[model samples]
Target: MTKLIHVAAAAIFNPEGQVLLALRSKQQHQGGLWEFPGGKVEANESVLEALSRELDEELDIQIDHAATRPLIQVPYHYPDKSVLLDVYKVSGFSGVPHGAEGQPLEWVDIANLEQYDFPAANTPIVNALLLPQCIAITGNANGTAEYVKKSVAAISGGAQWLMLRAHQLSSSERTALARQIRATIDAADGVVLSLNGSVAEANDCGVNALHLSSDKLMVLNTRTEFRGRWLSASCHTIEQLEKAVSLGLDFVTLSPVKTTATHPEQPAMGWQAFSELVNAYPLPVYALGGMTAEDVDQSCQSGGQGICAIREYW
Candidate 1:
């Protein structure tokens, strides 16, 4: 068996939402490609310590450790080696970032990251970067007009990602509502709309993504044909999370982080349990159920991509 090598990487972002990418030297592993600034974790240092040390060594900046948020962990295998990448988002830092190691560096816009070549392990990191920290879901609106109004408000309030989820609507009604919401989202310029239904429904509605219910998640053994569309699942247990990962879904929302009105009887996972589950998995997981935008920082610290709220967010 090949031993696992641990690497700590940082996605250092600027105020413009552009993340810093380092052009690996031609002689280095995965060289001549743009990658996040980081290095191998030393035996004696924690992942956080290694991350802070590496950023200072490679970029000549001191990261505010308190402000660092755990982003994603990616495990990839090359022909000769296996590596576990521990990545974090560095938001606060002292000193300007420069290529202190004599390697080329550039701040690339999050949306255009795919234009450059990156290591296979970094693909998920790039996807996570493109996703918003808070995903607003249109919850239990009384009518199509009400749903559209709330969705527009959410988008206008700076929510770049949204899930239109009026499960009570009939098939025809749902389709019509989806079209109206999609038009509104497009008018907002580049907002991503995810429909809470099956692949066929999402495709028919012409949405950007699909959100699978937990029951849908359990029945699927393989990824669906939603080419060019993001796929997300609602996960409750580790088993559900593992299933979603096996199906290669883009992200999952681990729910009931706190007791929600919809499921008051369901037990809450709490922050500690939620952290444990996410840390054990590599894919980005969002804290769902009774979450608000104000809980984003806490969610990040708990190893979540962010909060996926239905009630509070809307």
Candidate 2:
């Protein structure tokens, strides 16, 4: 096995909601690329400890340790090296940030981050940052009317990322609901709606984001081309997560973080297991099953993008 080089990185943000980035020195590996500021984790130091030290050394900033939370862990392999990037969100910090090490620093709007070049390992980090902290998944609904009404409520209640999971509805019903929701999203800026169904269904709906069930995820040997901007999956185990990553998915939802009323018999994985599983891959993960809007911070603390809930979402 290749030895993993552990690196601690920070998605440092100012009060303006812009993230701080640094330009990698041309003399360094993956040079001329923009990267989140961080450095290697020493054997004696914890990831947080390393992150604080690295930020101080690199940018001369003091991060508020309490406000720091695990963001994402990325495992990337090059021809000659392997690295495990343990990243954190630094929400509270004290400093007028500068290039303490001579590298140029820039605070960029989250929307404009894609305009800059980044190393392959940093791709997932960008995606994680771009995703909304609260995701609303539609649960049981009586008909297209209820689904549309509930979906609109979710969007109004601040769920920009909505997943329509109406398995009980007919294909045509689902399409109707999707079209209505899509129109609503179109009128509102930055709202996204994804379908948790088959490609055929997605095509019929003509939506831009598609989410696959775990069963569908395991059946695919490779990522089939889809006419969508975002592709995500439902994952329960490390194996499922591996497949999702292999498919180059945009993100995934790992379930049973807590026992739900619907699946009360199924043992909950709890937060520790969820965190452990999320660390295995680079894909942005959302804590699903028994999640509520209030659980977003806890989810982020456990290395998740945010909470994805059905009932308490809207």
Candidate 3:
């Protein structure tokens, strides 16, 4: 078995919403790339302790314990070493951060972070940071026109990300609905639209992102058609979440955080259990099934990205 190195990392942000990044020196492993600043966790240290200590030592900053939250934990393996990166979001901190240890530091805009080269392990961090907090999924509509209208309304009601799941519609109807949604999304700034269907349908609709149902998520071997685009899945268990992580998916929606009319047969995983399952594979997860706009804060506190809903979000 490969020895696992436990590291605590921080996605420290400034008041302007820009994140702090540090450049690795030429002598370091994965050198010449930018990375979130952090250090290895000592045997006796807690993750928060390590994070606070490292930030204070390396950047001369003090983290506000109340404002710190769990971000994502990444388990990455190199040819010779394996590491588990326990990441946190440091939104509240006091200090003008600088390169206290002679490392060059940069404050980068979140959207522009992609211009810089990052280690493979840092890829998921970028993706998570780029994602929106809430996603509105279109429920079953009477027709294609109604679907488009409802989706546009959801966007109008402060939902920047939308998942169009009109599976009841035929291919041509679905394409038309998607095109209308795309047109409205294109008009707005930073709006993202994804299709909840097959790759062929997504391609035909001219959208770049595809969301997979649980069954489809289990059967995929590779993201052959979705290499450059965002691919997400709906997962319910650790196994399904593990499959998503292994397949290099962008994000996932874990369902039944509470009892819902849609899937009453499936028992609700209360906030505590949901947190436990999420901690096992801490991808950017949106709480689905019985989720509403009101549950966003609780979801975030329970280690979720946000809420994915059909009714309440719309």
Report the lDDT tens digits of candidate 2 across residue range 8-34: 999999999999999999999999999
- In candidate 1 the C-alpha lDDT for residue 285 amounts to 86
Model 2 clash count equals 0
TM-score per candidate: 0.90, 0.93, 0.93
Model 3, span 231-270: residue lDDT tens: 9999987889999988889899998889999778989989
Question: What lDDT would each prediction earn against the true structure?
Answer: 0.86, 0.89, 0.86
The predicted structure with the larger TM-score, 1 or 2, is 2
Count clashing residue pairs per candidate. Answer: 0, 0, 0
lDDT of 3: 0.86
Q: How far is candidate 1 from the true structure (C-alpha RMSD, Å)?
A: 2.3
In model 2, state the lDDT of residue 18: 99
